[model samples]
Target: MPSLELKAPSLELKVPPVAVMLLVALMMWLVSLITPVIALTFFVRLFIGAMFAVAGIAVALAGVISFMQAHTTVNPTTPNSASNLVDSGIYRFTRNPMYLGLLSMLLGWAVFLASPLALTGTVVFILYMNRFQIKPEEKALLNVFGEAFLQYQAKVRRWL
Candidate 1:
C-alpha cells in the first residue's frame, strides 16, 4: 500500500482586492440603470443618502485611524508589506477597516443612487471580501505576527 502525503493548500491568490471592489461598484451601477426605482420620497431619500454618507465617512475615519495607529503604509492585499501591526483604536474593533471603509463607500453610492440592485451588490461585495480578501489577509497576518495576531483575531471582529 502506498502512503499518501497530505499537503496544505497555498495561501495566496492573484486576485486584486481593488479589482474586486471596482467590479462590485460597476455591478451596482448597472443595477441602478436597469431597475431605476425611485422607492423613497425625496426627503426620505436625502435622509437615507445622508446616513450612507455618514457611514462612508465613519469607515474612512476608521481607515485613517488604522493607518495612523500603524504609522505604516496602507496596503491590505499585502499583509507582509505592512511595517507594523496595529491593534489600537479602530483596529481594536475590526481587523480590516480599510475594506470596511470601502464597503461603506460602496453602500453610500448605492443608497444615493436609490437602487435595490446596488444594495444587492453590497451583499455580493461582503461575501467576496470575506472569502478572498479578509481570509488571505488574516492568514498572512498570522504568519507575520504569530500569536499576537491570533490574540488580536480573538478580540477584534473581522468587520464591525
Candidate 2:
C-alpha cells in the first residue's frame, strides 16, 4: 500500500493582517502622491469611495459576527486556534470576507485618490495576501481541520 504525502508550505513572514492593511494603505497614499492621475469631481469621487467603504465594512462586520458566533479565532496569525470553521452569513459567498473587506477599502482609497497608479495598490495587496498570509493560513487550516476544511475550501471561493 502506498501512503499519501502532502508537502508542507514554506511559511515565511507572519505579519498580522491589520499591519499589512496599514502598510498597503500607506503605500497607496505614496503612489497617489507620486503619480497623480485622472481628476474627477468631488461628489463623484466621494460617492464611489463611500460606496466601496460601506460595502467593505458591512462584509467585514458580518464576518466578525459569524466568527464570534462560532467561537473561532479571528486572528490571522493563528488559524490553528480556530475552534470552528465559519461558513454561514457573508462567509457563504466569500472565504476570506475580512481580507476582501480590506481589499475593497483599498479600492475605495484608490478611487478617492483618482489615480490609475494608485489602483495598483489593491492588486499588490491581493498578491501579497495570497503569498505571505493566506497560503500559510490555508496550510495551518488543513493541518488543524483536515478533510472538513478541504471540503469547505472546495465549495467556497477564496475571494469573490
Candidate 3:
C-alpha cells in the first residue's frame, strides 16, 4: 500500500486589518440599504453607533500609539516585524486591542444600519481575524518573544 500525502495549511487571503474592516463596512451599508431588518429610529441608532465608533477609534489609536512608542512594527501581515512585546497602555488590557477596536467599529456599523443580519458581518470579521491574523501572529510572537509573549498572553485577554 502507498502512503497518503498531505499538504501544509497556509494563510489564505493575506489582507490588512483596515482593509477587512472596510469590507465589513461596505457589507453593512449594502445590507442596511437592501435588507434593513431592524427598525431602530435614526436618532437612537446614530447615538449608539457614534458612541461605539468613538470608543473603538480611541482604543485602536491607543494601540497604535503604544506600538509607535515601543518602536515596534504594527503590520499584521508580518508579525515577525514586531520588535518588542508591548504590554503597556491599551495593550495591558487586551493583547489584540487594535483588532478589538475594529470589531467594536463593526458593531457600531451594525447598530447604525439597524440590521440584525448585518451583525453577522461583525462575527465574520472576528472569525477571520482569529484564524488568519491573530493565530499566525501569536506563532511569530512566541518564536520571537518566547516566554515573555507567553506571559503576556496569560495576563492579557486576546480580545477584551
**Best-fitting candidate, scored by lDDT:** 3
Candidate 3: clashing pairs of residues? none
| TM-score, every prediction | 0.79, 0.90, 0.90
Greater lDDT among 1 and 3 belongs to 3
Write candidate 3's Cα lDDT for 64-129 as tens digits. 999999999988888888898899899889999899999988999988888888998998899888
Tens digit of per-residue lDDT, candidate 1, span 29-108: 88888897767777777777778768767876777677867687666657676677788877777777777877777777
- TM-score for candidate 1, please give it: 0.79
Which ranges in model 1 have alpha carbons more than 4 Å from their true place? 1-19
Residue 5, candidate 1: C-alpha displacement in angstroms: 22
Point out the worst 10-residue segment of candidate 3 by lDDT. 4-13
Q: Clashing pairs in model 2?
A: none
Per-residue lDDT, model 2, residue 125, is 88
The lDDT values for all models are: 0.76, 0.85, 0.87
lDDT of 2: 0.85
